[model samples]
Each structure stands twice: as structure tokens, then as C-alpha cells.
Target: MEWNISGQDFVTFSRFVGAALAMGLAAIGSAMGIGLAATGALKSMVRQPERQGEFVRTMFISQAVAESTAIYGLVVAMLLLFTTGGGHTDGIHGSDWVNGLRFLAAGLTMGLGAIGAGYGIGIAGTHAIEAITQRPEMSGVFMRTMFLGMAITESPAIYALVISMILIFVMGAPDAVGVFSGNIMDIARYVGAGLAMGAGAIGAAIGIGTAAAKALVAIARQPAKQGPLVRTMFLSMAITESPAIYALVVSSILIFVFTPTDAEAARIFGGMDLVAIGKYMGGAIAIGFGTIGAGIGLGIAGGGALDGISRNPRKESSLVRTMFLSMAITESPAIYALVISLILLFVFAVPDTMSWAQGWAELAKLLGGGIAIGLGTIGAGAGVGIAGLGGLIGISRRPQKEGAMLRTMFIGMGVTESPTIYALVVSLILLFVASSDVSTMSQGLHDFARFLGAGFAMGAGAIGPGLGIGLATRDALTSMAKQPAHEGALVRTMFLGMAVTESTAIYALVVSLILLFAVG
Candidate 1:
């Protein structure tokens, strides 16, 4: 049999794919997680015959919690499949492609995000069983910790849901005439917005999972210190989840805040030429990829801190304080990316009439600015994680010298973040100060070269500071652990070394700024 498919039919097919992905993937995850939890609980009940009723009750509650995300996905899928009038004559309006892409992106955002939440809940539930089995007397505390961790792990899934809702109800609304209207560029923008939040949330899921897993292991090891451990775990989870929040903010801005006004859309479709779609795509990539490193760093630092506190409960307060500071410092790079994305989306306006060469130059500038901030921050995040791990280890080994270790860690982290600051400066220059004098294709090529140079300057410069800060932190921690009494002097010396090492990053920032304003 031969099959004939028109363009409209393809749009219809895309809608079906979106609906299936949204509900099917989420349901699979929920089922797998709930099944794992039930199995683990049943096994535990068999081992502890007297607590069968309690195990069954806990398992049911956990399954209910895990099912909520899947239900949300199902609701969204149904709406897309049955309620949307994408196939109607008036609804197509040449915007079927945009609607199809929007639906697909929305489904991916919720569907993939829920997979992580499901696995996270399963990990937490499994560990909860082990913890309760080993320390029945502290089962109450274990249950509390497990629930809290699961809730934290579910945050990225919630972020995805919000993005999906925005895509469906706000952007794809039937009444919003001409919103999609066959503008392929606008359709791409919507797709980018969905990915900005959806793909970005992946790191948060992994980070939360790691933090929760560490918390359960710590509880199993030291059930008596569950209070402090749980507190620290929650705090770290909050910090770990921040990158996803940043992505959500960017996605919201892209969906509802940034777009062509009705008048602007009319002008674009009528003869006036404008080139700003690249800016939206650039902004999305900046926020989406920028947070992955920060998420991983938070996980490493938070998990290490929890482990350290479990080993030496006497240093709980000091260790937590140090971890908080380190996480904040580590987040600076992601913050820089957010700032750059906002500027790209809202501040930069394309000229009403421009040569193709000038348009290309503008695209290069926006993309270069994004890459400068996004790739430049990854190393800084890793550096901060290393410093945090060192601080945790030092405090656990020498509780009496926490003050000195914390001071050293702060100085080292500041040094590590200097490169990110430099990248921020370079990105600012590329966004606002770079010249776009492109009368010919050759000039546009030159402009592109300058933007690319600026990006590399910042990205490459970030590497040195990351390695330097990690080494400085390691040495300081080792010294404090070995000679607690000399902590004060060691901390002072480490600060001096870090300050000297940070000068290289500063030089690179200067060169990048020069390339932006002068060369480009």
C-alpha cells in the first residue's frame, strides 16, 4: 500500500508524537519507581515480620507521592491530544509547524524530567528501607529524611511542568490569533525556550539524586545525628536545585516576556526586515548549558559535606557554614550566564533595516557573548567544588581549626571565581560595546573573528584559575589537618598565593574586552 501525507497531516502526526511522549515516558518512570519502592518495602517487611504493617503504609505513601508528576504529565498530554484545535481551518493559519514543535517540546520537558524524578524517588526509597532496617529505633527520622529528599528531588520535575504549562496554555492558546502565524523563526524561539528549561533541569535531577543518596547513607551510618544531618542535606539540596530555578526564569522570560509585539509581527510579515531570532536562540543556549557544571559542583560539594559531618558531628555548624559559602561562590558563573541571557533577550534590539552582512555580524556577537559566559563558568564551578570538599575534609579532621580552614577556603574560592568575573566582563563588552560595522561580507567576517576571539579568551583563561584554586585549597586543607595549631598562619599564606594566581585571569579578561571594542 502507498501512503500520501500532506504538510497538514505531518503536523497532525507531530501532535500525536508529542502527546505520546508526554504521557508515555512519564508513566513509565512512575511505574518503575513505584514498583521498585514496593519491592524494597516488601523485602524489608519479610525480614522484619513485626513491622509489616508499617512498611506497607510507608510504601503506599511514597508511591502516591511519586505518581503526582506522572498524573500532571497525563493531564497535559490529554489536553494536547483532545482539546487543541490545531487541525481546524481557522487554527492552522500557517502556524501548524509552530504548534507542532511547541507541543513536542512541552512533552519532552515533562516527560524527560519525570524520568529523573522517578529514579530519584526509587533511590531514596530503597535507601530508606536499608536505613530503617539497620536502625529501627530511628525509623521516624529516616522516614522524614527520605520524604524531604524525595521532595527536593521532585523540584526539577516541577520546573519542567511549569515550562510545559507556559508552552501550552500561554504560547499555544487558540484565542491568541497570529501568535504562531507561520513565523518559522518564532516557532524556533518557542522550541528553544522549552529546551532551555527542559534540558537544563537534567543536571538538577542528577544533583538532587546524589545529595539524597549521600543523605541516606549518612543516616544509616550515624542515626543519632539525624537532625543535623537532615538539616544540612536539605540546605545543600536547595543550593543544588538553584540552577534549575535559573533555567526556569530564563524560560519564562523567553515564553511570556520576550517576543515580537503584534505591531512588530505585522511589520515583519509586511516588508520590514529584522534579525533578532538568533538572539533568542543564543540566550536559550546560554542559560540551558551554563547551569550543568554548577549543578554537578553542588552535588559533589554537598555530598562530601554530608559525609564529613556524619564522620565528625562535632563540627556540624562550622562545616555547614563553609559549605553554604562555597556553594554561593560556585553559583557565580551561572549567575553571570543568566545576566547575559537577559541582556540578549531584552536589551539588544535589531535595526529595522540592515544588510545581510550586518545581520550575520549581530548573530555572531550574540552567540559569542553567550559562549563566553556559559563555557567559561564550567571550570570555575568545578574549582569551587574542590575547595568545598577540602574544607569539609579539613573541618572533619580538625574540628578545632574550622575557623582557619573556612577562611582559607573562602579566599581560595574567591580566587577560583575571579576567572568567571573576567568572563562576565568579556560577555558584557561583546553584548554592548562590540562594534558592528559591516558594509561588506569581508567586514562581517572580520567582526565574526573578533567575537570568536573574545569568547576563546575568556573560556581558555578560566582554566588556570580553576586549577590554581583547587591546588591551593587542597594544600591548605592538608596543612590544617596535619598541623591544626598552625592553621591561622597557613590560611594567611594561602590567601597571598591565591591573590597572586588570580592575576592571570584578569589579564585574559582585559585582552578579551580589547578585542571586543577595538578589533571587532
Candidate 2:
């Protein structure tokens, strides 16, 4: 077969050219936006040197936001220009049209998302600057608020990237190929989708720099408020870069989602048919949801900790310790989510589900395991709640003692939450580890896996009680702190009460460990 390249496919070339023009426009937009924001802040600072701190902070944030639209456009434009999958040969014009339309959609999505993020950050940062100017002492609070606001604003951008990626790869590539009976342009669409998201790297870089500059200025103006300011900056940056993470996600989707469709796949790959789709879908779901769960859980944990710190400034050390403990516990839910996802990837999504004997049985086992992982979140939440509540109470009573007590509490709380971790580990192993001669040669390993799972289920269920007892301990400590003269008697009684409360968590761990190792 001889394939001839034709210049008549000017439509594809034109689309690429349009993408370049868009990129240039976007750069101009960013430059204008940045210049406008910076000039305003600089002029304000010149008019009022005392307000320099405020203006600088505001400028940094505004510039970051302002530059977003241009960056997004640039990303889309680049995608269009660079992504031409395989060598192009003369093909039907309809395919070129599809590719062109897809690129346009991608450009629009990125552009809109960037604009939204920019506006959001500008509004929030401006308010924060004004607040700081009025009350320099409250800079910490203002910064934290600013970060949160910026994060929220960036969400739309993330959504845009996600949509753009889908349009370019999932919808565009396949449809273009179908319309034109498989042309180079179709492949180009997929590659372009990935390239479009690469712009996220630029956004992230600029965002981080902006955040750092703001933080530095804030610190320079108010050294005492440095701790809170740093924390706020970290959080804001995390949120800001979230859009970039989405870009990464979209890129990944683009790579996999456009795989030859069912009909085409059969014609090209020639396998058991339905098996591939199931496996791919299952794996996608598993990884997608699992990581999402962790991210959400962590976000909640971080927010709660931040709130606790802000509310009890004197007890920051204790609050921080509690935060760490809470985050660790919170991570359990994500671990379960991961376990479920991994199972989808490894077990449920197997290339040939029915190839093994008793296909239905294998399916049941895989699905049941995933469900168990998801359910594990309940226990993780309970454990974190317990530790968080107790830590808060302790810090509230004796702010000065927060540091010592916090460390102790976290260690104890971590130990208390150990069983949940063990459960997650076992679940992952089952999901990923191949079932083979080991099952036949040594029932111990196989039996241990199942036993451990049951132990984890029970162990996870017990986290609530464990937390309740910890909270009770905090109450007792608070009571004793109020009356130091009678501390001995209270201490003795508190220990007794704590011991009783701890018994349940202990029992759960013991049982889980025994099940995990000794039973077989």
C-alpha cells in the first residue's frame, strides 16, 4: 500500500496556525493583565509607603491570577501546534474538521478556566490586602482567607482542563478517526490533548513564585506572625496547583481513553472482545476514585487543623500535633480508597475475567474486596475525630503545656489507629498480589489474607469507642488542670478511666494482628 502526503489538507494546517495565533494572543493578555495589576500596586505603594506591605501582597496575588488566562491559552495553542500523532497522509477533510473543532474547544476551555481563576484570586487578594492594611496584626488571618479564596477560584480552571482533555482525546480523536476512516489527524488530536495540559506546568510555576513573593513580603512586614503566614501560604499554593494536578489527570485520560473503540479494537487487536473494556474501565474507576478519596480526606484534615490553630493560638503546638495525628488517621480512608482502586486495576479489570474457572466467583471476590476498602473510611473518620477532639480540649485548658501533651497524644492516638492501617495493607495485598500456587501449597497465606480482612473490619468498627475514651481522657485532664492541689487523686482516677476506655482499641488491634499472622 502506497500512502501519499497531500498539501490540500490545509484545514489541519490552518487549525494549527490558528492555535499559534491564540497562543500569541494569550501571551499578550497575560502581559497586559500582569502589567495592569503590578502598575496599580506600585502606584499605590508610591502614594503610601506605609501601605507598601499591603500593595506588594496584593500585587503578587493579582499578577498570578491575571497571568492565568494567557497561560491557559498558550497551553491550548501549544497542544494544537505540536500534537500531530504519527506522520500525516492525505485524508478526508471531515477528519480535519473534527480535529480543528476539538482544538478550538480545548483553547476555549483553558482560556475560560484561566480567566475565572484570575478573577477569583484578584478579588480575594485585594480584600485580604485591604484587611491587612487596616489591621496589620491580623495579617495571618487575612493571608489564610486569601489562600482559601484563591483555591476555590482555581477549581474552575481544573474543571476546564479536565473538560478540554476529554473533548480532545475521548470525543475528538475517536470521532475524527471514525469520520475520516482513520487519518493522521485523528492521532494528532490525542497527542495535542496532552500537550495542551503541559501549560499547567507554567501556571504552577508562576503560582508558586507568586505565593512565595507574597509570603516573603508578609513576613517582612510582620515577623511575629510568620508561623501562621507560612501555613496559609502552603495551603493556598496547594489549592492553586490543584488545577495543574487536574491537567495531569486529563493528560492521563487522553492517553488511555481514546484507545481503539470496541469495534475498531476487535478489528485491530483481536481478543476475547468484552474483556478489554471491562478491565480498562475497572482500572480507571479504581485509581480515579481511590486517590480522590485520599485527597478529600487530607483536605478536610488540613482544614480542621487550621481552624483549630486559628481558634487557639496559644495552643498551636498541641493543635499542630493533633493535626498530624488527624491527617494520619484521615489518610486511612484514602488508603482504603486506594485498595479498592488497585483491586479494580489488578483483579476486577483483569484482561480475561472469564479465563479463570468460576468467573462469577472471581468477580464477586474482586468487587467485594473493593466495597470493603470503601467502607473502611468510616473507621478512619471515627479515629481522627477522637484524637482531634481530645487534642483540642487539652490545648484549650493549658496552652503552655500543649507541645508536650500534643506529642504524647499523637503517639498514643497513632497506636490506637494502627489496626486500621493494617487492614488497609492487607486489602491492597489481596487486590494486587496474584493468587497462585501459594493458595494451593499454603492455605496459611490465603487464609491469613481473609482473616486479616475480617480483623480489619472489626478493628475499624472499634475506632469510634477508642476515640470516645480519648476524649474522656482530655476531659479528665482539663478537670485536673483546674485544681492542681487535688491532681494526684484525679490522675489516679483518670488513669483508671483511660485504661478502661483503651481496652476496646487494644482488643481490636490484638485480634487483628492475631488474625493477620497467627491464625494460619
Candidate 3:
């Protein structure tokens, strides 16, 4: 017996998988969020049996908000599966496979997008319940702050939803797959747009949620400082969401700009132009994964600032200033990531077609540059926050030792920032310095592995040192605050620890350098 398969069948099959992804990932986050809210409500009720009503009410509200993202996912899933699932013609036209990829990207965009927002909202809700338990009088304030944070946290997911909607309804809609899906480039655009917005939202949502949680507790501890704390919370959240905005901007460009016109599509039809694919998708990946660490770090620093101000209201100016500096350092990684993404999107040039060897090498180069910046920043971003938090903790405890502590903090932050700088350097070299114009298949594959390995080596290797140096700095600052007389000793110890901790990043740099220049 003989069997036959067609591209439209693949399209139909992809729709099923897309629906599953849309519903499945969406459910996981919302369920986790609901459980988190319930756990907090239960604990708060146990602490204050009489206030169960308020706790339950707040928990329910939080759960409801968290479910909204899942609902968006479900709506898209339903549409993908039911609205355009059947009764297709039998011909394999220009780009039915492109629609299949679009469906998958749309599903992923909505599904992964909701996770951070749902989880962040749950954290805010948990903090709200705890705040109420601590200060029953501040229930209203806690609830309001929680809601505000949850609202802001939803921004990333919303950007993702918009991208998903466009993927489904506009550019590569399943129903209009005949002419609209003319270009093979849509495959790159769809996947990149989905990834850019989807992964981008996670850290921002979580960061905003963290700020909200800290704000609620800060307000509860010092009810009179609610106004200023709330203001700080808003300011911090705004900054926290900026990384996601960068990703969203990149996604918008990928989806809207790279689309090939009908004539151009006719020229490039069914052609997997490797350079364009790599350039667009790599740009998306760079911004998408890169922003996560920055978002989380910003949240940590913001939370520290809120807590510090609550502890010593008179030193509000000092704490806020420190927060600005910490966040600025933390944001460096994301900036580097954004630069790589922009370069991939706008700066890199490619011809319409290439030799097989040439195409694959360029693909690897662009993708490697994206990976270098995106994965490399995670540790640097989060570590910066941890280190910054230590300084904030020290200053709040010993405000009189501001100048000494500030000096120590600055030194620590500078060291903490080194790994990200290394990643940035590695990414730049891959983008501009490395050679990829191979003439043979063996050479192309060699260069491909060379570039990709360098990226992974530097990116994965940088994470540990970024985190370690930050932890060391944080502990040193904390110790000095506890024992101001040991300031000199602590400062010396911190530098020593940082030097040792920095070795791993140096090793990554060495490996990356070898990969770029040593082989072939």
C-alpha cells in the first residue's frame, strides 16, 4: 500500500498542536496562580480567624484577575481549532506550511506570554493577604496596591496577546492562507514575533508583582508612609516593564516590517532564505530572552528601596538614589541584549540568496549573536539586584555610615557588571568580527558549530559568576552594616571574593575567544 500526505494536512495538524499549546501552558500558570492566592488566604485566615471574610474576598479578586490571561489563551485556541479547522481544498499552494508555522507561533505567543503575569499576580495577592494579617486596618490599601500591580503586570501578556491576534487575524491568518501566505519569510516573521513578545513578558510581570508585594508590606508597616511608598511602587513598576516594552517594539517591527509584498513574495516563494530567517528570528530571540533578567533584577532593587524607605522614612532620598543606581547597573545587560537584537534586525545585511554553505554560516552567526546576548544577561541582571539589595539593607540599618557604604556598594556593583560586559563583547565580535563566508559544506558546518558553541559557552558560563559576585557583594555590605567597625576588612574580603567569583566569567570569555579565533 502507498500513502500520500499534503501540506494542507500539515496545516490542519499544526492547528491541533497549536490549540493544545495555547490551552495547556495557559492553564498551568493560571492554576498555579489560583493555588498561590488560596494558600495565602488560608494562612492569613489561620492567623486572624475573624478576618477570613476579607482574606477570602481579596483572594477571590486576585484569582479572578489571574484567570483573565488564561481566558485570552483559550479564546485563541478555540478559534484556531474550531473556526478554521476543516473542509480544506487538496492542493499544496504557495505556502500552506507557512500558515502551519504561524498557527504554532501564535499558540506559543499566547501560552508562554501568560505565565509571568499569572504568577506575578499570585505573588502580589499573597503579599496582600499577609499585609492584611499584619495590619487589618490597611486591608484596603493592600488590596488597592495589589490590584494596581496586577494591572501593570498584565502589560507584557497583553503585548503578547496583540501579537498572537495579529498572527491569527492579519498577516498569516489561517482562513486567508492562499495569497497572504505567499512568502516563505512569513515563517521567520511569525516565529520571531511570537518569541519576541512571548518570552519578553515573563520578567517584567514578575518584577512589577514583586514591587507591588513590597509596597503592600511597606505600607502596612508604616501606614503613614503609604503615599510615598505607593508612588515609589508605581515608579519602580514603570521601570520594571521597560525591558518588555523593548521586546514588544522589536516584535512589532519583525511582524510589520519584514513582510514581503506580493511581487517580492512571488520572487522568493517557497524559498527558505536562510540569512533573512536568521536575522529576523535572531533579533527576536535576543530581545525576548535577554529582558528576563533585567526585569527580575529591577523588581528586586525596587522592592529593596520600598522596604528601606519604610524602615527609615527620613532617608527616602538616599534609598531612592541608591535604587536608581542599582537598577541602572542591572539594566545594562538588557541594553546590551537590545543592541544585539537591533543590529540583527537593522544593521545586518544579506543578499536574496546564497550558496548552501554561505547561507548556513550566516544563519549560525546571527543566531549565535542572539544567543550570546540573550542567555548571557540572565545572571548579570538578577545578580545586580541581589547585590544592590545588600547595599540597601546595609544603608537602612546604618544610615549614618552612608558615605562608606555607598563606596562599598559602588565597588561591588562595578565588579558585578563585568560579566555582562564580557557577554556584550562576545556578542559584538560574533556580529562584526567573526568570518562566516565558507565555501564548502564542511567549513560551513564547522563555522556553524564554532559560532553557536561560543555563544552557549559564554552565555551559560556567565550566569554563575554574575550571580556569585552579586551574592558576595551583598553579604559583604550586609556584614559591614551589622559591624561598621569591620568596614575595611569587609571591603577587602568582598574584592577578594569578587575576584575569585569572576574567574568563571573569564573562563567563558577564554572559551568564546578560542571558538571565534582558534578553530579553522
Candidate 4:
């Protein structure tokens, strides 16, 4: 008997082939676009070295726009394969092949559009840089305009992606078949996703490189404002990084969630559905981005605060409060990410259950853990804010007496950080330990218990004493500030206090270790 593909099978195969073509073709166009744009910008900058700032700002925005082409191609291909009924082999229709080809046409449209947008953005960046070199005074204004232009340039790519996704997912797939095509296809999908993330990496490297070069030039010109300029550069670069991270998150979701797996592999992926992976990855990225933002915010806040203190040293308390508020706001994103991570790892990661009772039981444990940690971070955030504010105030009032006040404030902050640490510990236990079926009394448990407790004991135990010494230093500074003539006496008292506090945290570490490793 002769073997021939059914109408449905042919359509499904065609859709897959189209997606591969769309991605491959778009990749070539994007590569050429990027090279052209970058080269033009470099030439412009070289010609007008004095207009470097304007040129760099323009170039950065241009490059961002150029990168959107690859993003477009990616979005189009995903939609074609996953969304469209053209990929459905269960249906019986002679029109399946035509529908599949139509889907392919949609991909082609988007792919070509991406190429044009990429080239346009690149050219825009090149010219903008050249313009800036000639008019250095208008650098800031030019930078703003450049970004606006780049954003507008990206609109077409976004539209193309939206259209392609609709064609594939909404119009094409109406009951896709052949999910059990061995593991080869799944592995290919995973590899493809991994490769896509390289585009994001490339964008990040270019952005960072450009930002760093400009920053060094700025610092060389204005050493006095070097700190603030560096902070600005870092912040801008981080914002640039957001898109790359988004790409990575999308790639990971595709690889980990969609791929077919054996019973063993299923044991890992099946623990949480596709939605859960998105949540976890999203949360992690949020945290990573927030951390970077916080660093920049803190630096800027500190610089401004120091300047304020210099002008009016007596109002130290008020200055500190402002600084604390800024820092707290800066850290909010990180805290949000932490809460989301806890929810995903604990609440979302659960075994499938046919019965309602089992499902509810799993949910209850997960939700309870999530709520507990979420609340803890809120408290931690508030405490740290207050402590930092108090420290800023104290430091501003007596610049010469900063050493002592800073010590005190740091201790207060340490105390504030403790609750958050506790919450983290609880979340980790819930995620890794409680979710697993391993019993506390098992041999595996014996190893885990010791391993965990010993690590915790050594770390947390050390923290307590370090905090105490920090407090002592603050007290000594305050005392010395009040009576400079009696500094010798204060120093003697401070050392004794510090030693006592340091000893306690150390003891806790020892006890924790003994409970973990020695007991086992």
C-alpha cells in the first residue's frame, strides 16, 4: 500500500514548515539591518567627536528599535505554530493545505515588515547621532526625541506580531493533533527557544557597551558630578535591559512548559502547569530588574542626600527621612517579585488530583505559605524605610559624628532585615521541602535536616552578633559626639558592648551547626 498524508496532516506539517521559514528569513534580515545601522552610527560619531553625547543617546534608541525586528519574527513564528488551526491534524478538510499556506503568508508579511522596521530604526539612530555631534547643547532634547522616534518605529512590528499570532492561534488551530511525535520534536522546540534568547543577549551587550563608553567619557569631563552621572548611566542601561529580560522569560516559558517529555521528564514539568512556569519566571525577572533599579535609586538618593546635608547639616533627621523614603520606594519592585516567587513556587507547584479534597488540601498549604511570606516582606519594607530615614537624619545633622549615627542606623536596619530573612527561610522550606514527599524521619531527611540547619545556623547565628556590634558603635559615636573631650572613656565602653553583642550571634551559629551536622 502507498503511504500518503491526510489533508489534516499535510496542513499541520505545512504550518510548521512556514514557521521555520519565517524565523530563518527574518534572522537574516535583522542581522543585516543591525550591522548597517551600527556602522553608520559609528561613522557619524567618529566624524563629530564633540557631539558624542547626542550621538550616543540617538544611537542607543536606534539600536533598541532595530532589535524589535527579531522580536517581531519570533512573535510571528510562535503564533503560527501554537495558535492557528492550520496546525490541527484531527480535522478532515481538503482546504487544510490552503489554510496552512495562508498562515504562512501572514508570517511572511510580518517577517518582511520586521526587516524594514529594523533598517529604518538603524538609519534613524545613525542620523540622530550625527545631528547631536554638531549641536552638543541640544543633547538632552535630542535624546528624548530619539527615544520617541524609536518607540514609534516599533509600533509596526508590534502590529505585525499581533496579526500573525491571531492567524496561527485563533484561526488555524481548532484541535491540533500529533502531540506524541516522540521526544525529538519537543527537544527541537526547546533548542529553538534557547537560541531565540541569544537575540536578547545581543541587545543587552550592545546597550551596555554603548552606555559604558559614554559614561567613562562623561566622568572624565566632569569628575565632580561623576557619581551622579554614573548612577544615571546605570539606570538607563537597566531600563534598556528590561526588553532583553522579557525575551528571556518568553524563551524559558516556551522551552520548559510546552515541550513533551518522558515519564521522568514529566515528573519535573508536570509538577506545575505552563501558567505556573510563567509566573515563576516572571517573578524572578521582576526581582532581578528591581534589584538593579534599587542599586541605581539608592545611589542617586544618597548623592542628593549628601548634597542636602552639606547645605543644612542641622536638619539631618529630615534629610535622612527623605533618603529612606526614596530607598524604600526603590526596593518596592524587588519585594513584589519576592512575593510573586513565593506564590509560584509554593502555591502553584502542586500535583494533579482528581478529587476536590486533595486539590483543596494542596492549595491550602500553598496559599497559607504564600500569605505568610508576603506579609513578612511588607513589614520588613516598612521597618527598613523607617530605620534608613532615621539614619539619614542623624548623619546629616552631624557630618563629623557620622560614624556613630551610621552604626546605630545600620543596626536598626539589620533588625528590620531579620523578619524578611525569616520569611525567606519559610518560603524556601515550603517550596523545596514541604512540596516533596520526603519524610522528616527518612535517611534523605536526615541528610537534608543536617545540611539545612547547619547552613542556617552558621549564617543567621553570625548575623545576630554582627548586628549587636553595629548598635554598640552607634552608641559610642553618639556619646563621643556629645563630649569630644571624653572620647577615650567612650571608646573603652563601646568595645565592651560590641564584644558582648558579637558573642551571642556567634553562639547561635554554633548551636545551629551542632543541631544539624553533629546530631546527625
Best by TM-score: 3
Query: In every candidate, how many clashes are there?
Result: 0, 2, 0, 15
For candidate 2, what's the RMSD? 12.5
The positional error of residue 107 in candidate 1, measured at the CA in angstroms, is 3.3
Q: Which lDDT tens digits does candidate 1 get at residues 1-520?
A: 8565443565677767877888988886678778877987888988898988878887887788778768867977887787443543444543665667787878877876677677667767766776677777878887888888888888888888888877777775233344432264566578768767865676666677668867887878887887888888888888889998898888887787656566545443311122465577778777876776677678768887888888888778777877887788777777878888888887877555567677667777787787777777776776787788888888888877767777777777777777877777777777777777778988877877788778778867876676577668867887888898787788788878777777777777778877776553
Q: What is the lDDT of residue 416 in candidate 3?
A: 84
lDDT for each candidate structure:
0.74, 0.48, 0.84, 0.46
TM-score of each: 0.75, 0.44, 0.94, 0.36
Candidate whose lDDT is highest: 3
Model 2 CA deviation exceeding 4 Å by range: 1-150, 153-157, 160-227, 236-264, 267-297, 304-329, 332-336, 339-349, 352-357, 378-386, 389-393, 415-419, 422-426, 429-520
> Per-residue lDDT of 159-241 in model 3, one digit per residue for the tens?
88888888887865333435332355678878998998988988888888888988888898889988889999999999999
Q: What's model 3's lDDT at 41?
A: 96
lDDT of 2 at 486: 68
Q: Where does candidate 3 stray beyond 4 Å?
A: 1-3, 85-94, 173-182, 261-263, 268-272
* lDDT per residue as tens, model 2, 1-520: 8655332254455456547655654555356556655665666666678878767877787677666666666766776667663223455444555455556646544653454345434544544554465566676665665565455545545555566656555564343332332333234334334332433333333343344434444444455666885676576457534434644554455455445445442232212222333233323333322233233333334444444454555566655566566556545554455445444544443242132223322332343344334333334434444445455555655566666456545654554444445445544544455242222323433553544354345435454544454455445545644664565675567567657765665665566455544655
lDDT of 4: 0.46
Candidate 1 wrong stretches, greater than 4 Å: 1-10, 13-94, 111-130, 173-185, 269-275, 441-520
